[model samples]
Structures are given as structure tokens and as C-alpha cells.
Target: MEAREKRLIFPFSAIVGQEKAKLALLCVAVNPLIGGVLLKGDKGTGKSTLVRALANVLPEIEVVADCSFNCNPMNPLEMCDSCYERYERGESLPIAKRRMRVVDLPLSVTIDRLVGTIDVERFLREGKKALQPGILAEANRGVLYIDEVNLLDDYIADSLLDAAAMGWNTIEREGISFRHPARFILVGSMNPEEGDLRPQILDRFGLCVEVSAPMNPEERIEIVKRVEEFHEDPISFYKKFESEEKKLTEKIVKAKELLPKVEISDDLLKLLAETVINLGIKTNRAEITTIKTAKAIGALNGRRRVSLEDLEKAMELALPHRLRDKPFQKPPQMKPPKPKDDKEHNHDHKHDHKHEHKKEEKSGSARNQGIGSLEQNFRSIEAKIPRIESKNFDGSEFTGYRSSRDVSITVVNFPKGIPVSYVPSKGEIRDVDFYNSAICAVLNDKKPPIKLEMKDIRVRVRKAKAPTLWVLLLDSSGSMAVKRRISIAKGIAEKLVESGYIKKSKMALIVAKGNQAEIFVSPTKNYWEVLEKIESVPTGGRTPLSSALYNLLLLANRERMKDKSVKVRAFLITDGKASVPLFGKRIKDEIIELAKALRKKGIELNIYDTNGKGINPGISYVPILKDIANAKVCKI
Candidate 1:
């Protein structure tokens, strides 16, 4: 059944328009030492299809027969301890040929499942190491594919980084340790619109390619026809590409054989180093990976000498993601204007020259002044706002409507949930942990299934659902700058953020400033970073309240799609004024419609009214906003 499914995969040779992605995969296939490839693009862009199809085109690898670790029989360094012992004893290891596999790392994969777990019972009873192979072990000499890599948990990503860097996985537990070869070509794909990986992990990947749906009409039509044909008759489609696939496989085999012989000139090497330095890439891995990738590319093209073109192509795949600036970064800071002399000002503006220039300079200076003043005001009011005692913010603490009840296996000893899974025991065995003892016993001992024992018992790990995503939309428009209202909004926002942080909730920020609304910060657990970003937002434009709400709706929908059980609570810190109309509709009507839309989506809305009695009177739009949004209104 698995073989048939593998046969039906879309042919790598038949994939359309993702030349860069295909090339990156081929480079890694030719030389796993090139590190790995990260495919970042939108949905339906063939990221997964390309990765799965890559296996069919890869040449067969020789492994020690019956070895769970896929130990390379010829290389003692790549073999497990058991295999190494046999090699040392002058035993001829049985070898088997098999196509390289594409091992998938699921989103819910636990650390134990990723880096092999130990059988405590076997260890204690036999006084020997009994290690179960993990995803990395199974992926040895193969491809490790992680879809939606950007959404991977921090710890899981760290585990991958450590293993990928060392080409080995070490499992240390309770004073016992085991190690195994974990070398593989790591291929990861993600939609950048969802989120981004941390820079440290991103650098671990040797190459990065951004893919998207083909824009050319002809190419798109061709892609559609090819996919439809495959769906109609997968076997026939596989046969059609069999020759091309074989040729590609043969080419990869040749490249791997020739990779060691391929050489780069010293001048070309110097050029590579100089190029990396110019790109401002700090990691030494960039230079090393680029050099290896260049050699692979040369070998793939049946060349022994690395050419300038190979170096250029290698750099093209290697440098883009390594740059300092990443996607969705905050816009650059506004520089203060240079003072203009009266004569120059008069020359530039003939009519009302002095008055116009003075007004222009004052406006720019005032805008800067307003931002400075807002920060200063926030500092003064910050202390007055009560500070809660800092506690470890766990997501499970939040409970309300739309909050997820899905079990989170990430947390241990979750006080109020039923056990859903059994993890490796951490020295403690409870009465309720007998659920998987038999299975553990069978896996630990080579003999027939035995009775459950305390040593074989696993730990019961359970937790509440995923955290609520809080989206804070701050009004940084010109009107809010009046009476230092924007400052008050910032203070309220900071307080809300702090409150959520204490609950271990994820927070996102959207600022309604200038002519548009921007996502200042994506949903993140780093509340302090969000607060810092909020402090720097300048105030000076029409209130794009509708725009802000529209963006909030989009963000909420995206988050919901990523995790269906995610509860989104949006806080609109504004004076309830909508000066900028989205879709050219009435400002009041647009705001009300968007609010209703948000409410219909089951997203909880809250209005933090910054209105006050002063020279600039409040518009009092909060009452209507509250009614339409079904929101809770808080006066600040």
C-alpha cells in the first residue's frame, strides 16, 4: 500500500515553474553535506509535492540489513554501536539496497519521538542499553521533510538544529546515554505569510528558496494539465516520466560520486568569501555551505571545476534568507530634516515662501516631537499603572468562550486534564500510568510480551488547549495625538499586553497610522518585545480604524486556520473615530460592518476608549462600536 502511494506521487521531473526549488532539492540530493534546503512559499505552490517526489528520483542507498538506524555498512563512523562492534569483530555485515526515504516530522511530534527514547525496563532488567530509533534515525541517509516549518515549536526546532549541526543525536537520561548517526538532508517548507523561523534555525538550512504559483498563463495551464493527467491515471503518469526520472536519478548518482573530485579554484574560493562578506552575513556556515553547494552544482552539471556561474547559482540559493532584514520588518526610522536657509527656502517657494517653509518644518518637527512626548508620557504613567507579580505565563491559565479544550502534550503535570498520551517516564510511576505499559514492555524486551512492571510504566502527560491569540490594534492617528490621547492608549495597551503576558498568552500588534494599517508585530509570546515595539510607534495620520479592523479580521482568520481551536481577542485602543474609510464607504458604516464581521467570526472584541473631556472633545463613537462589535467597553 505504501509503495503504491509512493508510486503515485507527482514526478519531480514533471513539476512546473519552481526551477529554483527543484534545483535546491537536487543540490541536496547530490550532496547531503550541503546541509539542507528550506522552501518558503504560499499554499498550493508544490512545496510538499516537490519534496515527496524527490525521493523517487534519488538513487538507492546501501544500508546494513535489518539495522533500524540505516547504518552504512562501509563507514564505521556512520554505524550504530552494535553495527560498529560487529564490524570490529571481523563479521561481514549483511547489506541491503533501498531507495532513500522521505521521513515526515509531524507537528505534534514530541521530543522523545524525535530523538529516540530509551526503554527503562530493558535497561534496568538487562543492564544494557535499549534505545528505540526516532525520526532522525529513520531519516539517516534520506530526506527529513518538515511541512509548515515556521510553526514548529521552539524546543523541537532547537532539537533539529543541534542534530543537524552535529550529524548525530545523543540521548542522555538518568545517568545513561546513547548516540547514533542522524545525518540526513533536511528539507523544510513553510508559508511565510503564516510566520517565520528564528534566525538561528533559519541559518542551519544551507539553502532557501521562495516558491509561488506560476504567474505565466501558459505555464499555469501546463501545470494544471499535468496534475489533472496524473490524477486521472497515476500509474500512466508515472510511466510517462519513468525515463526522465531514471535519467535524473542517474545524474544525482554521478554527482554524488564526482562530488569529492570536484574542485574550486583558489580565486573562486576568494570570490565566494568576498561575496559573503559583502552581503553582511555573519555566520561562517554561510561560507562553508556555499562552497559545498557550488561543488555540488558543478558535479551535477558533469563538471570537475567550479565555474563562476556555479558560484553565482550557489550564492543565489544560499544568501537570500541569511540577510539581516527579514520579511515584515518594521519600516526604517524617519530622519530629522536638515535646516534650510532663508534664501534657499525663498528660491524653492516663490509665493508665501517663508510662511510655507516655516509651516512645513514645524509640521515635521512637531510630528517628531509628538512621538517623543508620547514616549515620555508613557514613562510617567507607567509606574502609576499597577504591576502584577511576574509569574511563569502558561497558556492553559486562560479559560473562557472560544478557548481551546484540545490537550496540549507540551506541558507536563497539567493539574486539570485527562491523560491523552504516555511519555517516557522521568523517575515517577503513578497508578494512572498503566495505559501503555504493555506496549512499552513489548518494545523494550526482545522476548514475547511480558507482564507490566513498574520500570516499564510511562508518564502520563496532559495539558489544556493551545493559547488564545490576542490582537491589539492601537490607534496612532493624528486625532489621537490631541490631549496626549495616544499616550493614554499606549499605556492601556501596555497594561493589556502585560496582563496577557502573565497568563502566557500570545499577543499581536497592528498600528493604525499614516494612510494605512501595518502589522507591527505578529502573534508572539515575547510580550516585552511587543511592548518595546509599541513604544516606538509614531502618531500623525488620519484614523484608519476600518483598515485596522479589516487587518485584524485577516490575522484572526489566518491564526484560526493554523489552529482551529485558537481563540482570538482583539483590543481596539482608539477614540472610536474612523476618519479613513476603507472601500470608500462611510467611515461609521465601515467600522460597524467590520466590527460585525469580527463578531460573526467568533472573535472577541474589546474597546479601550481613550476619549476625554478637553479642548478636543470626544466623538463618542465607542457606544455604537461597542454595540455592533458585541464588545466590552473599558474607559481609560
Candidate 2:
């Protein structure tokens, strides 16, 4: 590979076609504090290329001298212990400003390289010493890029989440207690096909842009032509765009300065919030980020203040992943077409099975003539019907009111010797279930048993609120690297985030791959990240479906409040593809046992077979999961 410096592009301004993607990235670069953006779409969609091209648009940064990690020199808030100690002792500190470095992390990296680990050389050569810096240390004040980020190993994902959240990396590995500033813009790209990024990590981004290959032939041809030209001579092709790139660099500087003046009104803020919530998209962060992003967008457009149009533009992008109404809006309850008045109801009631009570109409119409016979039969049956005594005919026996469409059935009396009595059982009880469990005591001793009335007995269906938890177990297996996998996974993930499947229910994700299962993101509105992670998973390894699920059981416990929040659910989104590329045994029994344990925990397990047509041997393992508790299978 070429060195990082030489591979860098001309500038952001000269980029063609993908203007929206470029502008959004510029906003994030100008204000790292705005969080980050999620770029979604398909493979060869330029998700990776757009992000890589970002280095061209952004200006270089300054850092502390002699720091390999490129630690910021101006921000005292982020200095290391050694640097801090030196500063306090009145030492003259050196500084240097250079092009900002882009640190790309691979999925297979060990925890040692991500966080920090004891230096084996130090231990061996110096008989034990201080810990050494890791990749996080190098990533400070830079771009930490992770491609196929959705398939990241569990331990690695967790460490990155912790670091990104706190802006500081605290290592607890191998009995070490070291701390360092770890503020960096986390840029991750994934194709949703293979799997999704965890919800927790998705919320960290302030902006998210979805990109795809230009559908138009003209744009595609241009894309191809540009690539071919670059391939022929990168330097010459980049030079052709260099002047335009510099002009765009100046635009970023102005956007940054003008950002403070860019205003978003309360109305737009509310719209942003409402739109996202209306989408049933989870995450307070989306609302918060929209406010910030709207301002950045306003500044980029050279507007001093936000307008309805500005709000519209911002909300269009900000609310796409957040709208609840888009997917799960309940069909409005329709009022039954007006029933004919009681004049008709009375006519219908006039007819009795054995008798008739008829009303003669002077008009002599045939339809009205039928009403006359119906009335005669009604009177006859009413007169013959016997009334049961000592019954509380009051509707109080019912549990709750019914919808207008529901027909009500009431029992007038109980058979002789049979009583609707409450029976106490020897176990813990729920008040509602207890009510539903009641049965009338019946007598089998007499033939043609006589009937009696129960003073009070009521059971009704009441609307009760019980929140559900949904887990999305995304397959990070290599097969998911296919286009179908990407499209379906993206669509499914987006829909669920918008709560199309289970409304008002929280969702979680578990990414499973070679002996690795990680919460790439958490259950929240940062779903755009989930989609990107889904598309970006590279097809290079075998799937460790079993181990990933087992690890998920542990996370579910934490998420469901088996240790914390009592609400818990699990969604296993996979083509059900398994692999032996890793050490874990590729056995049907192991995966079955894992699913069984998941079922035992009361975790609502759903296996969505994302594989389009046939089943792979890895997918065959899902059948064995039936041995586990409360598991369901669906082809999503």
C-alpha cells in the first residue's frame, strides 16, 4: 500500500456528484464536538471512498511535540501524565503542527492493541515496568477509522465504546492503571448486509449520511472514467482537482467560523424532535444531534439564521432514521359506517326464532312487511323466556370495556351445584392472570343439572401496558457480505429501529462472527450506523454463530436488568450461516445448547433467516435452537 500522505486526495470541494455526503462530512470535521455522521447504502456505493476522501477537505492539525499519537499541544484538557508533570514543573514544552493522521483499525485486532497492554519487552529487559501506549493512544486528536465496523470483535467494540463515550481511555488490562486522552472522531463504515453495528456506538455520531452508487448511467460512467484516470496516474488526476480542492478547504474554514452564527429556531428543533420520535426512532441523541447538525448545515449554506427551508433540509436528513410514524403508525380506528337507526334495530329485534312480534306499516312496502312478522316472533320468545333470580345483572362482572366492534357475551346463570367461585392456588400470582384463571364449579352428579345464577362474575379484556424488548442478533458471517444480505439487513434494521415490528419496545443487537460476538452498537436511534455497519462487513472469515450467541446471553443479562433493566429481548438476524475459521468447534450441539440457555433465561429469541433461498449448514443450526426456550424463526 502507498504511504498515508501520498494516498491523500486533493480536496473536498473538487468532489463530484456526492455533494450531500461531502457537505455532511465537512460539518463533522469542522466541529468534531458535533459528534459524528453515519454513512450508509451499499457496497461500491462510495461509503468508504467518501469517508477516505474526507482527509482532503479538512485542514491539518497541531499537536504536542514528540508524541507518536499526535496528542494535542494546545488543549491542556487532554495532556498525558508525563506531559502534565513536565508542564507543571515549569518545563518548556515543544509543539508541532502537521497533517492530521487517519488511523484505520482492522476487525481482527486484539484488546492489547486497542486499549493498552503490558510491554513484554519492558518486562523481560527491565524486569517489569510501566505499560506501553496502544492504538487508542495513537488515535487521540485524529480519525479512528474502522471499516466493516459492524463485524468488530466484542472486546474491541466495548473498549472503543468506552473510550469514545468518555473521551478518555482508561486501561484495566493486566493489572495496569494507566489513563490518557482519547478524544477522536470515530468514523466507521459497514454494509448492513452482513450485520448491524450495535446501538450504543451509533448514538455517538452527530451526523449520518447514506450514500449509494449513482443510479443514472451518466454519473456511473463518470465514476468509472474517474477511477480509470486515477488508476493510470493518481498524481496527475489529483493535480487536476487540486485547485478546486483548495477552494473547498477555504469553504470549510468559513463554515466553521460561521457555525456559531447559524441559528435553528425552536419550531425546527421541535420538528426535529417530533419527526424523529414520530418515526418511532429511539435515542434522545438523534434529537440532540439534529439541533447541532441543522446549525452546521445552515452555516454551510451561508445563511445567518435557520429558516423553514433550512429546517426542512435538516429535518429531511435528521428524521429519516428517527421517524416512528413511517413504519409503525397504527391504522386509524375506523368508525363503523353508521348503522341504520334503532328503527331498523327494532325491526331486526322484532323477529324471534320461535315467534314473531310484527309492526304493520301503512305504506305497505314489502321490506317493512317483513318487520311485522319479526316483531310477532320477538314478543313470543320474550314472553316464554324465564328470568334467573338473585343474579347481579349489572355489567360489573366484566373486566373492562370493549371496543365498539367487539360483541359482548354475558352468561345469565350457572348450572345447579356449579358456582363461579374464586379458587386459591399454591403459587405466586398475578392479579390479572388470577382473574382470567377463574372457572365455574360444575356438578357432574346429576343428569340434566338445574341452573342457578352467580351473584357476581366478570371477565373482560383490558388494555394493559407491558413493554417488550427485542434483540437483533445480526449475522456478521461472510456470506452476509452479498448484496441481498446488505439490502435485506438494511431494510429490516431500519424498519425495526422505526419500531415497525414491535412498537414501543426497545431493541438490541448482537454481532456474531469467528469466535467473536460484539455489541457493535446498542439499541437506540443511531440506527443509521447499524445500517452502515451492515453493508460494510467484509467477506473474509468463517462465522462463529455459537460463541457469539453465548456472549449475547451475558449482554442480555446486563441489558435486561437480570442485573439492571428488567426489560430484555434478543433478535438473532442471520442467514444462519456458521463457520469453522476460528477455534470454536463448529458443532450443531454447541449452538443448540447456547440457544437452549437463551430460552431458559426468558429472553425472547427470534432467528431471522436473511439468507434468500436455500439454507447453509450454518443456518441449519437454527433448527437445533428449538431446544432452547421461547425461540421463534422467521424469514426476513
Candidate 3:
């Protein structure tokens, strides 16, 4: 048993660095109610190693002996059908204790595999309905570790997140219905350079940790030695940390018992909210996670009350991912007015009010300053990661881009939207679908008892409408490079990529510079693909507005040819600096003619003015393009 365990798992205390990440994992172990954690780092940062090692340090849990869902014996109210039925029978259910395991979810996991599916073979053979439990069932009361989580399919990712958040996997397929407990600590590790997580999925994680290679030479040497030792003699390395792992397990056991008694005072709650608000976080999940994590830390230290230090640690783990910090924005200040009471007794009241107001004003101002300082620190850490600023596109573009169409198709079917139809062969079967299929079977049955057969089986046919195509006509000319205009354009393009992910839309990037117009990326629905192309875009070319407009016309024509019903919108990002022309004609005349022709193609153009004062000596030509294209105008 000892040798088997050592072979199966890595020792937690054996990990050399990533103290913060280790602490964050321990905090969640103490209190799974703190939600789950996301680890963002580069490759070879020990993110996955730490998570795998965590299972060894976590104490065993008591679950129903025969339950595949790992149903908690103590929580009868939340048990699965089998366990609940056993409980209802007034039978003493056998309990088994096992070590908490780390269940790995690979990048290629499918939705049906993450969530359970119907047992079609058994149902067809003996008319016995059963659920084939999946990863969620196996992960209950343990850790669900998703490696390379950013690369996971978007639909599968969405489904896993939904189950993780709800703590239950509901399955209704082919007349087999089941709802099993899916409560588990979700640990997702990803290299941010590969891709970015959607905001919705990112927010679902309770804590976000950033890990990197140890900078200190001593620490780096220690990591290398430990890794080498582990690889050379796994059993010896495991034994070396066995005592430490046992102590950690004991600590976690105690922390779990103490977590409920751990109190978060109003002061801590106020601090959590103030910290999140000051950091420009709009969601309340971060605030709740912060307080819960602080309490968990307090519990780990055998304390009854959370401390300011705990709050600080919690902020460090929870704020970085949620912060929408604008480095240029000034820290907010509290403004207080002098009290104006006239009565003799009111003078004392006024003085007290003034004192309280002054105190609050100072505290609020200090918190804001602290928030700014914290953001600066975060910026220093993320300096290597280029951040995309939020879209500042003018009102009309915002409205036009946000207006999503409602049309259904049989293409992409994410785990969202309403279920509309039931086909003979696809999608998960809901309870209603089962009854519908059962009714259809009964109505056609010649025998009495109304037995259903495999031919009677029906599944849901879900449909999702394809989103609009946003064509970005970016000006990568020399004029855009002046005064960081190119940087701003890149930032805007990145924002569009994010928007495309949220809106479920496709984005096409067209860059015109250096005497030519080229397609950086054609219409693509994948955010990672768009981001990769956006990063490779070259800057430093003469503005060629006429050539760019012609390309847009060609693109619009091609998209229409592919699908006439597909909606296409174009955003022209430029400084109105058109110098080159098509066929050696006058530049202005060529642009005007092309712009008129582009408008005729039914492609909506939103022109963003990328000009700063004195950056371009040419007179503003945006008016001409706007007139010819009848486009919406916006100033960057």
C-alpha cells in the first residue's frame, strides 16, 4: 500500500517554491466553500506539480461506500438517488474513508464526459435505465484539476464551469434521469501566453494565483535539487516528506473543523469591499471570496477572528485577476464639508460630526491610495503581459456591434441558450424529452405494458445562431506609430477580440500599410487565433486608404458569396491620412470612389479618428470618407 501510494502521488511539502500558490491551495482545502482557484503561470512553473501534490496532503473524507458519486454520508439531504433511497429505507449505510484525490481533466474532454451520460446499452438490453458517471462524479469531494485549461474547448469549458459552480451534475438523457453531487475544488492551471480565459470563466474561480520560476539563485538551486532527487528516487523523496505531509493533513483536518468557528468581523468585510471597489472590481464574487479566504487563513492559524494581515493576503490572491486598473486614472479622494449647526448644544454635535466625517474621509482616501499602490505592484508583476484596454469606441459603433441577431442553426451548441428541438440522435435528453419519447413509444405499442425500445429513443437537437462578423480595418501606417497611435490601435484590436469571444462573433482583421493592404486574419471565431495574428501585425508603412477600402469591398463580396444572410460590419481605424491611390489616380478621388462603392456593398463602416494634434499636418480627411461611406464617426 505504501509503495502504491508513493507511485501514484507526489508529496506536497516536497515542492520547493511557490509559497503563495501553496498557501492558496491550502486555504481552499481548509474551506472548499471558498470556491476554487486558478493558477496562471508559464510552463515549468510547478503549477501542476503543486496541484498534484495537494492530494497527498489533503485528509480523507467519509462517503457512502457503494456510491459512485462519492456522496457524503453526513449530508443525506444532498445525496444522490441511490444513497437517498437507502437513507429512506432506514438502513445503516456503510461508510468508507479514502484519501482525497486529484482528478485530472485533459484538454480534449467532451461535455458528455465531463458530465454523465445515459447508459444506452443497458437501457436497450433490459429496459434498465442507468447513468454512466463521468469526471464530475469521480471528482466529487476531491480536487478537479484541469491542466492547460485555457486550451480546453469553449463548450466543454462552459459546461464544466457550470457544474463546478452549481455543485451538481444534472443528467436527463434517453429516459435515464440523475442528479449527483459535483462538489469539488476546481484547480485550473494554464500558461497565459497561450490564451486568455473568458471573463465569465475567470470570475468563477475563487482565487487566482500567479506562479513563476524562482528568481533567487538559492531558491532555484533548491528547486533543481529537489526535482532531481524526486526523479532519481521517487520512494525516497516521498519518504523524506512523509512526516511533513502527515502534519499538513492534520493541519487541514483541524482547519476544516475550525473554519466554521472562524469569524470575519464587520471591519474585515468593510476592508474587503473597500479593497475590491478601490481596485475597480465591479463583481461581488471577489469580495465574498476575499472574506472567505481570509477566514480560511485565520482558521489555518487556529484563530477565531480574521486579521488585517489575512485580508491583505486574501487581496493578493483575489484582486490581481479581477482588477480592471487603469494606470492613468487618478486615485479617488473623499470630499467633506464643514458642518453648519447653530444651536449651542448642536455645536458639540457638529464638532463630533466633523470629527467622524474627517476620520472616514481620511480612511477612504488612504484605502484608495493603498488600492493604487497595490495596482502598481500588480502592474510591475504583469509588466511583461501586454494588457488590452477596454473598448472606447464611440456610441454608434458600440450599439451596432452589441446588437446581436437571433437566428438558429445546427452548428455550434454551447451549454447555454434554450433547448428548442428534439431530434432523433443528438444532444442530451432532458426529463421532458424522455417523457415525450416514452409517450410516443406507448402510443405505438401493440403490447400492453408499453415497453420502450431502442428505436423509440430520442435526443435533443439544440441550435445556436451564428453571431455577426466584425471586420476591423486597422491602419498600421507610419502615422499610426507616432505618439503611440499604433499601440492604441493594437489595444483596440485586442479589445475587439475579447468582444468577439463575449458576443460569440467572428472577427476579421485587415491591415493596410507599406503601400499595400493585407488581411492579417480572415473571419475567425476563435479568440486565440485573432490574438496571435494581432500580435504579429507589422507597423511602419505609408497610409493607403484607397487600397484598404478596396480590400474591404473584396472581403464583403466574398463573405456575401459565402453566405448572403451573414451580417458584416467594418470598423476603419485610421488618422484620415490617405496618400496612395489605386491605378495611379489621385489618392483623394480614389478613396472617395472606393468609399462610395464600399457603402453600396451594404458593409457598415465605423471610422475611428486616430489623430493627435500636430501628429499629422494633413487637413482632416475623415470628413471626406465619412461623407462618401455615410459612416459613423468616432475620435480615439
Write candidate 1's Cα lDDT for 1-636 as tens digits. 745766689989999879889889999999898889999888989999999999889889999997999999989999987888899999999999988999999987766678876664565455455776789999999999999887776557878889998998888744557788999999999986565566676777899998889889999999999999999999999889889989999999999999999998765665566445544457788778888998999999999988767877888888766654322222122221222332212223342353355455554433233234434555565654333111112322112223224324344533223345667666544423432665577677744435666677676666544558899999999888877678667777876775664344688999998778999998886665687788889999787877898999999888988877687888888887777778998877787788789779988887766665445454556777678878876655
Per model, how many backbone clashes are there?
0, 56, 2
Candidate lDDT values, in order? 0.75, 0.57, 0.72
Model with the higher TM-score, candidate 2 or 3: 3
Instruction: Kindly report which residue pairs in candidate 3 clash with one another.
Output: 172-429, 514-541
Candidate with top lDDT is 1
Q: How far out, in Å, is residue 302 in model 3?
A: 3.1
Candidate 3 local lDDT, 314-417, one digit each (tens): 87887677654332223343222233442212334555565456556655554445445434433342332233222234433232245435444553233433
lDDT of 2 by residue, 490-555 (tens): 444544454412233445566676557767766543444453454454444667686677767776
lDDT of 1: 0.75
- Estimate the TM-score for candidate 3: 0.69
Error of 2 at 101 (Å): 2.4
Evaluate model 3: give its lDDT: 0.72
TM-score, ranked from best to worst: 3, 1, 2
